[model samples]
Target: MDISIVLNLHDEAEYVSKTLESLEQAMVYAVKRGVQIELIVVIDNEKDDIGTIVEQFNFSVPSKIIKVKNCSLGPSRNDGISLARGEFVAVADGDDLVSANYFYDSFVFIKKLEKNKDRVIVFPEYVMHFDRFCFITKFVDSDQFSAEDFAYFNPYP
Candidate 1:
């Protein structure tokens, strides 16, 4: 199955290249696993040069840069999704770095499952910074589906 990574960005000129490089690594891993993936970078701010930076990245799969007037996260992501042509959509932040094997691992797990549109799977993330600090956070386990836990969790903006 093909996947589209909707990467949202604001004024991230300094970090765009690094983030995109990390994403490229994930895409390479996905390709090696026999999964197709594309990138749709949404520059939320019209004046941001993040789009220009995205142009420098060499991607094996389809990739595009979109600039939007609406700077909000939700709308920016919505705009990216509108241009997506993949069966599965993965939301990523421009400044965030994911593991190199993220896309490959996720696709492998998903491809083995039965088709169920209602099922949603989320992988845990670790927040990190250049200052050498990291916060590993867990949202849910395979066997744990607690409504009360989800009710209080605000995992995304």
Candidate 2:
């Protein structure tokens, strides 16, 4: 399968190296299971480090790093899309790791989701872990909601 991986990064210099290393392992696993990845890394312009990170590793691997000044998820995702040459794009943060099964399974599931023209997005159900507990929950598409809709919205910030 041919796929594009869009990684959104910002002022995460501390964790980005570990994150990228993990991503490299994940990509290796994906390729072994028949996936060709086009990695599009979109980084916020301020205090950039993605370039250094990509260079620190062996660039013999396939990937592209893009820098956008002060860009957020929406713009970075758009920027990634502009650079993507694959048929489908998978989303990830600069700090998240995908399970080994993610590539093989999501490839099957996302294909079916694409068939439903009415559904612009298909999200996976995730299990949340809090201090000593875990619970399964539905995923949220943040773009579909207003501040008034999310009852559990936190205001601590």
Candidate 3:
């Protein structure tokens, strides 16, 4: 069973390199645990110069860089959703750094729940960083699934 890391990014040139590095490093750990990761990087920002860094970055992640003109996270995610070929889906922001064992742990947990066969949606405990503080925010066990919960926000120009 494979997983798709739907990385949604806009003009994140400032911090994308570091994010990519962290993801690449995490992929190494995830792979060692027998997880096949497919990176769906949606570049809603610029594509031309983004390649300069993307190509130079050394990572073995099987990535398909989708360069969209001017799309928001909703459209970007929808686009990726259309082509997703994995059994499960996970999302990460452009600036956020995911844990090295994110995929490893998720895969194991999902397989354990025989009852919840395909309802494996485990978002990580967010590593929030404020002005001079940092902490983790865990995913809330949903009370219910409403359309508003996953509703699309305003689009980009």
Per-candidate TM-scores read: 0.82, 0.70, 0.77
RMSD of candidate 3 to the truth, in angstroms, is: 5.0
Candidate 2 residue 154 C-alpha distance from true site, Å: 11
**Best model number under TM-score:** 1
What is the overall TM-score of model 3 with all chains considered together?
0.77
| Candidate 3 Cα misplacement greater than 4 A, ranges | 47-49, 114-118, 130-138, 143-157
**Per-residue lDDT of 1-157 in model 2, one digit per residue for the tens?**
2778888888777667876776777777777777777787888764666668755765323788877875567987888878888777887776665566665566667667778854545445573433355555556666666787657663211
Tell me how candidate 2 scores on lDDT. 0.69
Cα RMSDs of all predictions? 3.0, 5.2, 5.0
lDDT of each: 0.78, 0.69, 0.73
Off by over 4 Å in 2: 48-50, 59-61, 112-122, 127-157
As a whole number from 0 to 100, the lDDT of residue 134 in candidate 3 is 64
Least accurate 10 contiguous residues by lDDT in model 1: 131-140
lDDT of 1 at 122: 53
- Ordered list by TM-score, greatest first: 1, 3, 2
- Write one digit per residue (lDDT tens) for candidate 1, span 35-118: 888889888875556666777778777888877889699999999999888888888886778889988877767766635544
Candidate 3 lDDT for residue 57: 70
Error of 2 at 85 (Å): 1.0
Best by lDDT: 1
